[model samples]
Target: METLRQYRENLQKIYGKNDYWMVPIFRSLFSMTFLFFLSRYLQMTGKLGNPMVILSLGLLSFFLPFSFVPCLSGIFLLYYFYTQSILLLGVGALFFVFIFIIQSSVRGKYAILIAAMPLCFFFRIPYFLPLLMGLTMGLSAVISLDLGILVYYFLRYIREYKDKFSTGGDLVEQLDAFSGNLAPFIKNKELFLVLLLFTLAALAIFVIRNFSFNYSFETALAIGLCLESTAFILYPAVGMKMNLTGELLSFLLSAVLSIVALFFWHDADYRGTEFVQFEDDAYYYHVKAVPKKKA
Candidate 1:
């Protein structure tokens, strides 16, 4: 009884903290405004046809609440091919336009990639391109918000550590000293690992197919999940200064894992069984063993 009371008290303390949720709301608002301005520039200057415009458009629409519109619409179209395919497709296209509208509110280039997952899933689009889109967008927004929080904490740390600095030149000199110490840890190990995993995923997609390893919607979805989760878990770590570079590193690992998951799903034969189904107004799925793996 005493232990239970203590646990409940701990839970109350943790739940009482409300500031964590504020950054995401702020990020969404900021990113939305950034996208509006960017789109206006592109459309007015008539540079929307350029490849850079594609990236810019992606940045604009990545963080909005309505960003998932095209994704849901596309999924509906696929599911209701007999009735609403055309209408759903048009809606999906419009949603894509919105995604292009709010891209820049985030800070990192990679965050844009994270916002494109739902679109790929909705439209049955294949390949790592959409994964790239969602990750870039999500990462960008996450990094911006995180950096602001980090700066606040860093300022506090400086105040407490003021005695450690000997002279007026301490700010730059101390920061440089700190950077020099941290340089070894940021030597691209995480980046290389992530790229290697992605490369393996690409190879698997090509090698796993009978005649050719082809990219599929499953592949994109798998990778997107991995990447998003990576961003999710790593963001707080970065903000807390627990592992400054861990977010990027973990994201890379997550990306690779996602690719591998996609391959597994691809290789598995569904045997005409539906992976997801709605029954009595509730959605569910039937999990089946791999036929070849059955004893």
Candidate 2:
């Protein structure tokens, strides 16, 4: 525990010193990574998908606010959809407009979860979403995460159906068939399972972490991972096939990583905790303060 606390202090010192350049460098890498995955997922090896082009665009992203990365991703997505069909591109446009409306309204913290969702899904390490978002960003992060998951599955199902639907049929008929098929996809057990598990687990962790108690964050992470693991373990009973052993192993790995993240992001000294009471002209206040550990 002391080692972890010391490491976090050293990390903060380094970040404080280099943040001016480090943030942009990290942002560039994140943008490039997102585009790289976008290329592979969309199977675009053209100019837009070129590594040099991706690197250039990523460098440009360093000058833009981090929020711009999502717009950048959407533009890339829309272009990919354009390569597929004019109609498809229109659908993607409307989808982005809808997402923009919601994202603008809430304007939650850790907006990058919108991108992280698809990225983690692609990497098959989605088990960390609940604990990561809940512990770090609280319940509001779940909204962004939900959007990301929807984008991932939406793109996934659309790609699977694109070839089947784009057989040069009547335009209206194709649209009708596309919208019609979405029902079953919407009802997909896998989609619902992801939504349910992530929502509940994140919410649970958010609530637990807010409690004023010793080891609240650690307890929250443990319980959240247990809940998530249990849900995945019972997927077979729900008639959804999954590799039980593989899922368990993934959960275990995610749990270890979540612990590491929690230690760095949230650690306190209960021994240094203080309770105080003060009376002002208006009212009296009772306070409990737990100081975060530092080197």
Candidate 3:
């Protein structure tokens, strides 16, 4: 019993301080929720491809925010250049050129941004909202992928570089021997509590969706909020132990909850919202009875 306790303590020490516990949990929950629901939404209308394609979609989802940072900036600069009386096109183009330089330099480390760039306009959402939504969604996605990448490399590195870093066993031997070791537990009791909480959250989502069809927007927003908050609370503790499966499941559940929140609890129309351009080159839309006009 004491040996198990010490082993768990050593594992925790390797992960970090107690403060880090929430990192894995929250990250898994949020990333999963965003990817699952968003994919489901895309799937319903036949816009999505096969399951393998959809499963891989989260890989593209993570970098949308970083890409949006440049995309939106570029868009705004272009708008200002054209709409206002300014010879800013050359300046804006130059700025984007610089951005490309930075992007290329960091491309190996931040390749996800390149993938998310095109997805910004795919939803045909309001310009600002897409940027915001894409970012929130992308954040969870990126962090989740990063965690997986870090875990794989960390495990591999501990094997290859173990002697250089520590007086422990030969790196390769240790790594090859690790699979036989019992998986480390972050907080066994706490995990059960969290799982129960997630189950309850799932139930809440189901009840909401059953009665509501016009819920996509609210669902998206709610899941975004929940995942973000929970991630803030859990990712540190769970770390890489919170694998892709856990992340995927949490995200899917959150998406369902979000859908439920939107249709059953909130008032919004998911269909028949037309993007109408008015005489003064302004656009307005009304989904059901909700009025949305451009500034």
Top TM-score prediction, candidate number:
2
Provide the clashing-pair count of each candidate structure: 32, 0, 24
Identify the runs in model 2 with alpha carbons over 4 angstroms from their true place.
165-170
Q: 1 or 2, which is superior by TM-score?
A: 2
Q: Estimate the Cα RMSD of every predicted model relative to the unseen true structure.
A: 20.5, 2.1, 23.0
The estimated TM-scores of all candidates read 0.23, 0.91, 0.23
Q: Which sections of candidate 3 miss by over 4 Å?
A: 1-182, 185-215, 227-292
lDDT of 2 by residue, 1-295 (tens): 6776787888989999999999989989999999999888867768877899899989998997678888889988888788777778887898888877777766645567788888887777788876798888855678888888878887888767776456477778878878888776768888888888888889989999999888888888888987887776668878888877877777777787788888778877888999999999999999988998876
**What digit string (tens of lDDT, one per residue) describes model 1 on residues 8-82?**
556546656853655345444444333333234223233433446535433443454443423332232233221
Sorted on lDDT, best first, the list reads 2, 3, 1
Question: lDDT per prediction?
Answer: 0.38, 0.82, 0.38
2 or 3: which has the higher TM-score?
2
Q: Residue 233 of model 2: what lDDT? A: 62
Candidate 3 per-residue C-alpha lDDT over 1-295 given as tens digits, one digit per residue, 9 for 90 to 100: 3564455557557667653545544333333343444334323223232345434443443444333333433443344333322323443365456545555543333433332222221322111222232223332333322222222222233334323322245645544544433133223443343434333333333344344245544454554446344643465565524444655554555455444333333443435454544343575643334333211
Residue 168 Cα positional deviation in candidate 2, in Å, after optimal superposition: 4.7
lDDT of 3: 0.38
